[model samples]
Target: MLAACRGFVFDLDGCVWQGEVLSPGAGEVLTALHRAGRRIAFLTNNSRATGPAIRAKLHRLGLAFAEHALTPLEIIGSVVAERFGRSRVLVIGAPELTAAVRAGGHDIVDVAAFRTATVVVVGNDFELTYERLAAAARAAAAGAPLVTPNVDPRLPIEGGDFLPGSGAIVAAVATAAGVRPVVVGKPESPLFRMALRRLGLEPAEAAMVGDSLESDVAGGRAVGMRTVLYAPGAPPAPGAADLVVRSFVELARAAGVG
Candidate 1:
């Protein structure tokens, strides 16, 4: 399959590494694929870190990829910049999400503390509040696009309980405002388009490797690319992946990387 494909894209959270713990054989498979001269990209919906921070983590893990290989924040930044340039944004998400908004040259204002905002961007904020939710609802009612980073209802923590992800907030605000926000994450957004542009390959020639069936495999299928489900502890959903493996080493072998 590696010989048949020009590039590979992976989902980071569950596919590559779960939190600080690396998935089994992730590094080895990535190394082998790199040596095989296949282009690799990490296409993640995680809004918790900037691309630089993620790249740093991958580097520490000895994973090889170029600077332009990451497509999460940069893709989001471009989307926000294109739609809401210089507009005041009510940000209710992680610090990384806020940074992405700011890096796109938009203004971040406190939700309850905001007055003159044209848009409200929602991601996962551990410190989410009813007051902030109310404020976001007000902005959405006033015709601002309720932009969500990813619509994952629950995000898995490392060996712990799941937290309500951006999808939760989107649902709450949409319920209060009577409109669904525009979700910009895997399987829906321009992330794959950005990936294709970065990889310089057609969608049919690319493969997506991820653990989550909802985000990674679904995203790949949405764009007509081949999908590989890499489960460390999680398994593939029925009919979700073209292939399923427990470790990246198996994924590599299946891809003909060895």
Candidate 2:
């Protein structure tokens, strides 16, 4: 199935590895794909890291590819620039995400400026606080529309642990503001469109590979691409994915690679 596709998009955390540990055969599968001349785009909804940082992490994990990784930070930045045009944003996320937004030509205002900001952008913030949340909520309530990179509720950590992701923060603000956020990451069309555009392939010419049923599978299906789910120990739900593999070795084999 994968052999026919000219481009391949992969989700980072669960699809490639859980936390710091690389998934079994992940490096091999990627190397095989590269050797086969397939265009690769590594997509992550994780807002905690930037593209170069993610590339560094992937290098540490023994998977080296072209530095063409995509994150919601870049996607959100483009969206904000296009929609609002240099609007001031109250950002709630990692410093890296804040920098990305600023680099995209948007002004990053402090929480004190929340009410005056045109948008409230939320991402993964390890240092989330009630004060920040309150300010964001107030801003949203005061007509600042909420924008989130992704609404992933939990992020996988090492040793089978999980951490609250940006979605948690978004939910808090949304509940307080009584308005749902405009999501820009996976399961949303913007992220997928960005990936497809980078790959220069139409949806039917590429395959979306990941471990999440909701994000990867549903997003790929929605965009008219083939979907491969790489979850172990779980039964495949009806029409959840076009292909299901337990490990990267299986994924490679299914792709007609050794």
Please report the candidate that would top TM-score against the real structure. Answer: 2
| Candidate 1 stretches greater than 4 Å from native | 64-71, 84-86, 113-115, 232-238
Query: lDDT of model 2 at residue 2?
Result: 76
Estimate, for each residue in 1-258, the C-alpha lDDT of model 1 and write its tens digit: 545887898787766776777777888888788888888887777767666777888888777564444645666666877877777888878888888888888877877556677778888888888898899888888888788778878776667457777788889988888888776787684887788778888888989888778788888888888888876666656566888888777887788875
Candidate 1, residue 254: Cα displacement in angstroms equals 0.8
* Model 1 CA RMSD to the hidden true structure, in angstroms: 2.4
lDDT of 2 by residue, 1-258 (tens): 777888889998877878989777888889898888888888999887777788888878877675678788776788888877888999988898888888888888898778789889988788889999999899889988888889998898777688987888889889999999988889987778888998899999999999888898899889999999988667677667889888888888877776
Clashing pairs in 1: none
Q: What lDDT does the true structure give each of the candidates?
A: 0.77, 0.85
Could you list the CA RMSD of all candidates, in the order they appear? 2.4, 1.5
Q: Which ten contiguous residues of candidate 1 have the minimum total lDDT?
A: 64-73
